[model samples]
Target: MDHVNISVANNEEKGANVDFDYSQRAQWLRAAVLGANDGLVSVASLMMGVGAVKQDVKAMFLIGFAGLVAGACSMAIGEFVSVYSQLDIEVAQMKRDHITNHDQELAEKENLPSPFQAALASALAFSLGAIVPLLAAMFIDSYKVRLAVILAAVSIALVVFGAVGAVLGGSSRVKSCVRVLVGGWLAMAITFGLTKLIGSSGLQM
Candidate 1:
């Protein structure tokens, strides 16, 4: 089969075709960064929270290690689910547009020329979104906070991130902020609660 290259340019006139590379490397990078971030944040929080209740260095060390492992796994799974969901939505939207445009194309095949391009756009946006939190984790020292104030601050940061993400994605910023912040708080709350419960049990053990 002979291949004919077509250009989809911003201008009305036809232009030379450009080749591009598509890879899963972006998703992996996002996951790695977020995983490390979660490790820093959660372990740091756990150590701090536990330290508040007691000044036992050995206990704090143990709790920190546990938190690091648990948090990293949690982050990886969460990132995978989120990235996959975003990918799914992008695919579904593109599929829908293609289907809608298919009939339009049949009617005017010559005029409907630009192929659907939203999938790549959404993926790139999501990848960048994941990276920000990761960077924050790298910069913020996670070992110092020993109070609920720390939790509150991180929650606010998450809300800001969600708002930015929503804005970038052309979504409702308020809704996104609430949704993301609430989810982060819920996680923090659950972990904090579990720490109290399990820490007591550890003492007994």
Candidate 2:
């Protein structure tokens, strides 16, 4: 009877640990998907806006590169600050709870969010997403072809990202893909239309 009880308790503990690990994985995946989507949409829109006003390949490359660098840095800094704040709150809570055992406190701190890790992950995800449009337009010389390729590449990327996110999150893949695709199209279209309209008004630079 004692052996059976011990085995059951150990099995329960193992199951709980697995659940905790899975939850952590889900949270990480969610963050990565969101960061990548933001980077893809923002950089692609910026490129489309620039392409609308100026068909120069140099101009498009410059704008896309600038957007990637700026977006990555912004994401890294924002994530670092946000995660650091959360870490502070968690540490404070632990203190309030009067965790007396050093080993216990250390274990809790180990599980706390690492601001550096979060920042790096955010930056890398943004850069990865921002590279799609840049690479799509890189070899294409014709202005119209470049724009079309960029749109195509970005649309494909958006769909892929959405599908991956949906799979990991256990959501409806069709809905997720459609939502991401539509949102990306709207963003690029709006930026292009607005920039073209403004440029038509004889705005310089």
lDDT of 2 by residue, 58-115 (tens): 8998999999999999998998999899999999999899999999988998889888
Each prediction's TM-score versus the true structure: 0.41, 0.89
Give the clashing residue pairs of candidate 1, or none.
none
RMSD of each: 11.8, 2.7
Indicate which candidate wins on lDDT.
Answer: 2
Query: CA lDDT of 188 in candidate 2?
Result: 97
Q: Candidate 1 overall Cα lDDT vs. reference? A: 0.50
Among these predicted structures, which one has the highest TM-score? 2
- Give candidate 2's TM-score: 0.89
Q: Write the per-residue lDDT of candidate 1 for residues 63-104, one digit (tens) a residue.
A: 765655455445545555665676567667656676566665
Model 1: how far residue 48 lies from native, Å: 5.9
